[model samples]
Target: MNANIIIECKDLGKQYKTPEGERVIIERMDLAVKENEFVVLFGPGQCGKTTMIRLLSGLEQPDRGAVRINGKRIQGPGPDRGVVYQTISLFPWLTVMGNVEYGPKVRGIAKKERREKAQHYIELVGLKGFENTYPVKLSGGMKQRVGIARAYCNEPVVMFMDEPFGALDAQTRYLMQEELAQIWEKEQRTVIFVTNNIEEALYLADRIIVMRNCPSSIKREYEIDLPRPRNYVDPEFLRLRKEITGIMDKTL
Candidate 1:
């Protein structure tokens, strides 16, 4: 059976008026994400990958075109679309359990039920014992785990991630990537991940969409067939990476 189509973007565009006047950031872009699909939108900095995610999440409206989630047009942020940012946006005053329960609470889940949901995800992300710990005390990777738990606590239909591991050091970032992959494998939620790292994209994406520089548009779409726990140095992997790098070079 085909995975359900969760998101669709048709001729999406965004423009901003700056000191230099109207600037086009995205144009004539169309994309789709299927249920439980892991997709990476990668390109150079300022390539509008983040902008595209925002549009899909309904954080920002496009100047033209439309974005729909589950066949309904998206207009604003809602529980159906969960977002995790580069910075750990957890409430410092809240314990791990409290932070995770925040969403369900606001959505009117009873205290006992919300707490149960929170605890489940906390354990799912390997933070079971840290339920009472504060965000300030957790390591970078652990904090991101908390963020992921919080996002998933709501059982969102689609998760939008904007460089969720970008702020960590190399080793921690790699570990987090693997951890995220593990989580995705089990839950299988639709995911649209935005990053500038080609290797990161290759490692996590079921399909990789490369965007061009400013006046950003989809340049290429490559379906990665490499097996999981991929070796970046494998011949096929290196070939695809080099080919993507060459295309990215021309856009610069």
Candidate 2:
């Protein structure tokens, strides 16, 4: 691995047994993500994007290859990798502060210390006034903000986001994308984001890796050199979007 590479997988493969037959989801896929780089995995639905995140984050093991982070092979989930999901899995019973502080509190940090750390992240995610609010009280976008804060509070070196904004209304999704991009610009981390939205990918990614349909592998890679806070209608943006979409395998 290159010295700058923070996470990498080599010759990765995965499959599953089903009543119909064995199904392959990923095959001979290899990727390396550099430190503090925002890389987006863009693909059609059911393209194993989530599985790739799980494999890289150590939530699941690859059947035929290995994932390494900072020169160490990953065995399982660790504090070094954080995940935010589309479902916004915040503890419903826990307040925003409680949810954000959960990781540090479980790791045995002092209450005052963890609370301070959690407060910083809450404010960072633009939820300062909602610290005492529960998940049920949050809007869809706010709940995802809490999820992002909770993940960031862990101070993970890498963050794997599996379609974190996919469930939001279109207007809200666009808002969250801008907010997330701003947040990332303020506090950079190695981010591996999964999404099927071409505009979202172009807006947030330093590089976008397009994936093939099920039994997925990299179909193409685009280095997005466009300026931050990207214009959705920019000529280059539309050109790349159209080009990428043109090559994608259509879903049924």
Candidate 3:
């Protein structure tokens, strides 16, 4: 593993036994994510993007090859990696504060220290006044905010997000994108986010890895050099979007 590369996927592959036959998802996928770099895995539906994230984050084992972080092979989930899901999986029984502080609490941090840390993240994710509110009472966007806060509360070395805003309304999705950009700016962490949305990938990723359909592998990689708080209407953004979409279509 390269010292500066925080995450490494070396010829990683995965397959599953289905009634039809053995199903392959990823095959010999090799990639590296640098420290504090926000990388997005973007591709069309059924492209094994989520499966790739699972393998990268140690949620599931790859059939072949290796995944390494910080020069050590990833055997399983650890405190160094945090995941945020598409469904905003917050505990309905726990209030906003409870959810955000859960990780630290379980890690056995002192209550006062954890509470202070959770409160900071709660405010960071814009949930200051709603600490007592449970997931059942919050809106879709707000629930995702709690999910983000919870993920960050652990202070992981890298964050894995799988289409986190996929369930939100269009307006809310855009808003969350901007908010996430701001949050990343404020607290830098290496993030590997999976999405099928080109605009979202363009807006968030320092580098975008476009994947192909099942039996997935990298189709192309784009380095997004746009300024922070990117504009969807900007000419450069639209041009790159069109170019990437055309490439994706060709890949399909």
Candidate 4:
């Protein structure tokens, strides 16, 4: 598919006021995310990766500059951009279907239509038989799948995910990673994922954006030129992983 710009962040900067003084987190960051692209922002904790995601999703405004989605300015969170957080921030009280339908319902979609839409994503995330289960009844990985279903149910143009698999155990994380790849392969929505895991970033991203330390900026971009169903032991894949790990180790 030909790449077209779907999201643009220009001179995006963000700061927080500390008791001591103002602490700059991101500065003059310019990024363009093409449609149907899977881009990962890789950095250690507190390195402003999530902050950048929030900025792009319009959850928080930048201290300076702006985020534009398909040539239109993003003023605040809308149904067009959906987000999944590291913690699987689902409402404990809502059932799986309820959670998935929340977005469309809030947007005034009719009850029957929202239910059908939610069911579509529930099935898409492989939770068809567990539609009525509450968050508390689900496993960690299951809960994250609900979050993914909820995000996709609204048919968002872009999906911003912050370490959606971070909380799962090693085995579960790997399973979820493969599942995510399958979902993205079928759906083909623009995804901006944030993670500190170099391997995870490489496995899921078409391009990886490596960010610098506080007052963060894009340091390097690795366009993963590997074939689908990429083998971990492939020479090129291994080389890129080692190279990215070296850069991360140096920065940390």
Candidate 5:
């Protein structure tokens, strides 16, 4: 493994047993993500992008090959990886502070220390004044913010975001994208983000890995060299978007 590569997977494969037959989702996939690099896995629906994230994050075991993190084989979930899902699942009963501090609290960090750390993350995610607010009161975007803060509080070496803004309204989605970019700039982490939206991928990723239709494998990889806070209307951005879209499998 390269010293700069925080996560690497070689010839990884996965399949599920269905009543019809075995369904292969990933095949002969190999990838290496460098430290603090934000990589986006972009592909058509049901192309196994989520499955790739699961395998890399140790949420699901691959049928063949292996995933390594920091030169060690990934056996299962550990503190080094954190995940933010499309649907925000905050503890309804817990306040923003409570939910953000939950991970450290469970790990037995001192209350004062954990709260301070959680407070910092809460502020980082633009939720400073909402410490006592419960999830029920938060708008969809705010809820996701809390979710991000909670994940960041754990100080994971890598963050796996599976279409984290997919559920939001278009305006909210755009806002969240900008906010996420700012957050990443402030505190860098190795992030593997899965998204079907080309604009979102272009805006957030340092590199975009396009996957083939299931049983998915890398179709192509693009290094996005655009300046930060990308404009959707930029000529180069639009050109790349059209080119990538042209190669994607059309969904029925």
Candidate 6:
């Protein structure tokens, strides 16, 4: 409940009834995210990374413990948190401008004001010229751009991204990672991004939390002190990457 800590997950635990039996996905996990901190949740196996995000973001309730944002316990999903998913869930019928403005529009923001705000975010995500384009016509990376813009247009206090770039091709994935890092640099937000990609995690994260698989908990944490626009092949970067990989390799 510190002033600078925008997010807190205390002794969080969750269980699900599976076909086999009751399955525990999270186990008494504790986490705190500082204001405007970019944190990545990385793991080797199918840790409950997504489940943790859902619980924290209020998409699901933990059977025990709590998730707090700004010292208040989360009850359910709200505008203060914006989420981008692996599927790039854009409105197929809506154009880029329409989709980005959807949240504001639903919240009764005036058309002119929302349009101006939407335009700013659209340009910010490098999609100014494609305002009229629909999701069906855009490429994978471009659609994710729209997703990011749409999330930003809400002006959320925290952004929870669950593998937003996981499905992209390698070249496009790398490009999107670079672009996302640049975007985060310009517009700082408390971002909790989940991914299994170590390079992507290192490139974008201010701190990386390595999690243990199924019945997950934080195994290790690394504060990345390297400068922005980090080089993948930099010796220090490689060394850290190797160290992280070695740590997670045990979970396999």
The alpha-carbon deviation from the true structure for residue 150 of candidate 3, after best TM-score superposition, in angstroms, is: 0.3
TM-score of each: 0.96, 0.98, 0.97, 0.95, 0.98, 0.98
| Per-prediction tally of clashes | 0, 0, 0, 0, 0, 0
TM-score of 5: 0.98
Cα lDDT tens digits for candidate 6, 1-252: 489999998899999999999999897688999999999999865788889889989999999999999999999999999999998888889999999999999999999999999999999899989999989999999999999999999999999999999999999999999999999899999999999999999999999999987778889999998998999999999999999998883554
Q: Considering only N, C-alpha and C atoms within 3 Å, which residue pairs clash in candidate 5?
A: none
* Model 6 alpha-carbon drift over 4 Å, by segment: 249-252
Position 71, candidate 6: lDDT: 92
Return the lDDT, model 5, position 60: 93
lDDT of each: 0.89, 0.94, 0.92, 0.89, 0.94, 0.93
Report the poorest 10 consecutive residues by lDDT, candidate 1: 243-252
Task: Name every residue pair that clashes in candidate 6.
Answer: none
Candidate 5 colliding pairs, count: 0
lDDT of 6 at 78: 93
lDDT of 3 by residue, 125-189 (tens): 99989999988999999999999999999999999999999999999999999999999999989
lDDT value, residue 37 of candidate 5: 98
**94-168 per-residue lDDT for model 4 (tens digits):** 999889999999899999999998998899889999998989999999999999999999899999999999888
What TM-score number comes out for model 1? 0.96
lDDT of 4 at 39: 93
> Which model, 2 or 6, shows the larger lDDT?
2
Look at candidate 5 and tell me the lDDT of residue 113: 100
